[model samples]
Target: MCSISFLVLILFSTNFFLFSLLMLIKDFCMFIEWEVVSFNSCSIVMTFLFDWMSLLFMSFVLLISSLVIYYSKEYMGGDVNINRFIMLVLMFVLSMMLLIISPNLISILLGWDGLGLVSYCLVIYFQNVKSYNAGMLTALSNRIGDVAFLLAIAWMLNYGSWNYIFYLETMKNSIEMEIIGGLIMLAAMTKSAQIPFSSWLPAAMAAPTPVSALVHSSTLVTAGIYLLIRFNILLCDSWMGQVLLLLSGLTMFMAGLGANFEYDLKKIIALSTLSQLGLMMSILSMGFYKLAFFHLLSHALFKALLFMCAGAIIHNMNNSQDIRLMGGLGIYMPLTSGCFNVANLALCGMPFLAGFYSKDLILEIVSLSYINMFSFFLYFFSTGLTVCYSFRLVYYSMTGELNCGSLNMLSDEGWIMLRGMSGLLIMSIIGGSMLSWLIFPTPYMICLPIYLKLLTLFVCISGGLLGYLISNVSLFYFNKSLNNYLVSYFSGSMWFMPYISTYGVINPPLVLGSVVYKSFDQGWSEFMGGQNLYNKLVEYSQLVYFLHNNNLKIYLLLFVLWITFLFSFFFLF
Candidate 1:
């Protein structure tokens, strides 16, 4: 089953990749519509758009998914439900593909909801408390996006069609269009984990590593970026663009900071994915849709490799994910370490690597664009923090003394896993340059001051040094985090974002529900409803029975009184 799945994915990926190239060369787009129903000059149609963008994205998603599934064979070897896991992953890929190819809002919603449901299942694959909580958070957070899509769909009815692509140019200043744009942005924000919606991404790491690689890299998170790219016209000249820019910038900074303070290896990587997502979103908001798409593709390559390497290490380390308990893994697992470091360098945008082609260009473009100092500062500082966390991760996991037991054994002996990493490893090395040349035939004209151009390099060096120094511990070193425990905890806990997303969102509603249960359901409602009505009916029935009871003495007394009253009335007249 695994072999057949892999072969089919590879076949489709190659075909799509070739077709995308052809479309790019010819500058052609094909829209296929099949009308499911028609009445009174109205038609319901399933529409597909075949263009360079959609085809290329589909190819990349399929390629990454195939490799991840291949890797999972070894990773999930001991699991009894391996077939179930594979099916879920395939379903996720299918949903993503549906989302990619469809130009209609109704179809997009179908794909959007599918992604959410399938992700929830994958997240809870282990059937544990953490997994369950993470799955719920993942599902609910995405439910927000799903609702946004639904609203956009309903609002698009004002335009008489669900095909938003056709109206992008004509509906520029319309209020309904603006509302739809805002709704799309809101949905994108949630799916991409920007700012307030950021908690769920890291929480979702409770899923298996292969799922992490697939979701964090290409399919789930990038779905929002792709949607925004498709609807870039709506956001280019709107207030929604500016709002997105601010929130995404903050998201970048927040994720980078959070990653630095994180100890869990997977969480740190998840945070890095969050940081990259912010980069894509912020750039997209700035109207550089192509650059955002470029970064999206490039990021998918290396991030997947990074996660797979982490998975290999964790698997051999008895399922331990804590970086503090790891060290000198490079000595035993040389191949995995080599691949891991390569991926890290790519993430840091090292020269000539996949990340360098997109990330470096993005930084240069941001420097050239007219933007606020706050945004400018965020772009550079986040870049630095990315390097900082990455270096810290490397120090804790690769460079120090072995922190585990003397009898511990670790090696890159999992050939299947290594094979999977190798495919992404090559892509991480060259995919950026390839994508850049293909996506942008005309180069961007970037003009910036020398100091500004050098800012990215400066931050990287400083961040790396800071990461190493902070992580370098001595035998008698004092723990400053304990002294400043509150600050440390807050910074380390993603600024309490998880608490805000979970408890803050849940507590008020729960309290209100309790109050309603007591004040209404149990209190006023009971009095005004069945019980009160029953008491009133009982009292009325008792009164009637008292007034008209069958008794001989009572009847005789009543008759005598009636006669006496009639005689007294006559005498008075």
Candidate 2:
């Protein structure tokens, strides 16, 4: 495990070195005497690594890759194609690094598309048809982002701001700027699986557990949130920014609600991911960039930890992932259950854990946004929904009566998996200290009303207690219809606009092609016209066939003579 992590560190170090070199060349090219040569050289460097944004993204790419590599060595034991899995995972990380660090619009485009491609491959690493279909669905669904990013690249290139620095400096007030912003937001929406793009994420659980942790929790989907944060200056001033906040708030509410009903352990976390992203997006929408980033940092720790724990549970339980099959795990897998319980509590904003500080800030930011009452209600409701579902996650998996599967009656996981969870647990406990200065920078601490902090704690605890009540075994059967209504209809079908926009982009051509193909199978005459023509040709050519067969040698000579005559005729003509 240590060796694997060392290799990942080396991989990131080399990639970062390459990016730094490209950046230096780009800077140098700006002042060289040979104008055309300098310009072309700069363009190449720009296409590689030319911006502060990419540099910022590199930190996340490296951090998450290091953690995941350490994780895989233990999680994927005895799995075939271990080398292939590592290569693909590395490729995914590299693609994200490129996407984040590319200096030119075209390079950014490649990185963007490359991340999508690599993620699709990783999603299907299991070689199961279900995983493959999930990968295909994920790829197809996100193609909407490709269109948007491609358009943004084309627009920027045409505007003479194709380079990263040029784009940041010059494209501010141009009409193309707004177009680019809109395109970028569209891409972010799809990449993050916001609203209508949400289903693909739950489906993506077909991947291996480690992939889910990396993809949903730590890295790939977060890239969109990172994009929004990096461009907050540009987006915050526009209506698009406000729209993102509203959409993000709604996504949080629905995702939280969805998690309430998810029985699958991984899917529950997947929904939590959507909810957490929604919260980050909502905070970002309000121009609280630092606070949003703080939440993002804290979220990465707790969510990744939670997902890793889920992976362990699934692994030990003969690959069973449904929480319904899980209960009393705290008795069996004490270390894992303890780590997960702590993470879950922090995830739902328990006090002192990293999640509390970050989540409360999001609520505060939401309260400050000048949204309508409906939006306000949604935000508040989402807060309650968050507590309820998060508590359910803990109760269903850890605290309930023991109902271990025959395969996982009692077992222990490898040290590598436990190490990842332990690392996250430590981060969760002490990570909030990094932001302590943000809350209390001076020697003298500025204190909020005790009641208010207590109120915040009260709300969180009450929400958790309510969730426990709602998910208690005795009450579960009674909540079935309510659960279906909330998860299936409200969570899944609620994103009418985002859904149409996300799916509509890919559906039209594919649906048209499907219709065209299906028509051929509908028994229409035109569909069978080619077959009829072939049959008629065969019938009419029977005399020719018989004449040829009657004298095979003569026919061969005649055919050769005809071919020679045809070539001679063409040449003469």
Candidate 3:
């Protein structure tokens, strides 16, 4: 694992530099698609896109994955299945690459499906209940998107080509194109864990930390956003676009609130991821694909680093995941703590960092756009809540009193882990400004009121203050009405999404199945189908035998009795 990771790391670093130079020379260049299957009207082509966007995304995916595989060498040391882990991560990277470069729907589905399947395998690699459940959830949730993709391909059949890039301009107003846009939007939402489908992402924390760092927080979740980025021009002024804008705002707000209430160390990070994804989706809805792409890159860098740091902390804490039991680790593990704080601050969109360059610009864009009051409320509140939870997280795990049982088992120094994190940590710090320069080349012209310009700063400061005060209070004893059973339970369990998806969506069908089995299949079908007919036939046959009379004298008497019986039957009738 270590050797492979190191080799890939060096290879991608070189590739990245070369791509950077090439991008400077040419704005965009696409390879001629190799024809796979040519039909009467359409052909399945395997093509590669090598624009700056795909190149940059692929470079980052490779970089993070290499570090993750390298880090897994130490974190997963002594495990029997460590090799399998590394191989899965490698396959994941391959899938991400395929998704990034593919220009046709067929190849895109190949990549998308690969990611969903491989991630499920990774999630269940632990062979425990939690891993099993999480894997199922993740797989099933993504399956919805896979179906959506297949539907999209079927819909594209009307356009006579699976290469959607060609149709983006001509098909924008066609009614059939609306179906395509809506299906693609639906697919993107599921893959990105938006709204009702979002339960899978945080639950997917059951995967090992390296997997979470490489897959969930970065590549897999961003696949949807990337697809939408490529399809952005088609979505303008469409109903799907408007729906996406609304859903994204709600998703951001929901995930932010969920993060505030979450206690699991990994899950908090995961929920934060969901919120950021919402932000990206919302921005994309507003027709700022470049900004979404920018934030996507920056978030990948820091979120990957953040998860890796969390992995380090969890390793040192003897495999414990509860934040309530963790505190004052900064004193014992300053290096890992420093990385965590850096990532956290970056996540909160701290000044001049990677997130700030993209996030601040995104907020400014939203402010400048003509949007409804509801959307504006969701946008700003989610932004402020981001700061609140970031501070809350830092205080709970890094600054409060040490509650972990023993220091003898804690480990602070792991050179492999630190080395793995170093690459992304550096990227997390400078990726935004670097990409901002490379991507935009020219800055966005901003004309806003002074108050609007300072809103981000004000939101950050106020949220941070509230975060400190809230973290200091006793949450269970805060004595607020929202702490009641229904409200607290709803918020704590992510608005009962687990129940809605598992019990609500899945169990009802199972219950109906049982009913169908017993009532229609077992009872009525059994009696009415074969058995009742056979019993009636047997009874009538037995009675007919008595009337048939075998003896000759008995035959005479039987004939006479039959005549009398016929007379009596007629009279009775």
Best by lDDT: 1
lDDT of 2: 0.73
Q: In order, what lDDT does every prediction score? A: 0.92, 0.73, 0.87
Model 1, 1-573: lDDT tens digits are 677788899999999999999999999999999889999998778999999999999999999999999999999999998998999999999999999999999899888889999999999999999999999999999989888888898898888789899999998888998999999999998999998899999999999999999999999999999999999988786798899999999999999988887889999999999999999999999999999999999999999999999999999999999998899999989999999999999999898999999999999999888888999999999999999888888988998677877888798899999999999999999999899999999977777889988988988899888887777742126755567788888888888999999999889998999999999999999999988999999999997887698878778998999999999999899
Over 4 Å off in model 3, which ranges? 36-44, 475-485, 518-573
Which residue pairs in candidate 2 collide? none
- lDDT score, candidate 2, position 305: 81
Q: Which stretches of model 2 miss by more than 4 angstroms?
A: 5-43, 47-57, 168-170, 405-408, 435-455, 473-512, 515-573
lDDT of 2 at 187: 89
| Each model's Cα RMSD | 3.7, 7.6, 5.2
lDDT of 3 by residue, 10-80 (tens): 69856975786587568766666788899998866688877777887887787778788888989899789
Off by over 4 Å in 1: 37-43, 473-476, 530-573
Clashes of 1: 0
**146: Cα error in model 1, Å:** 1.9
Candidate order by lDDT, decreasing, is: 1, 3, 2
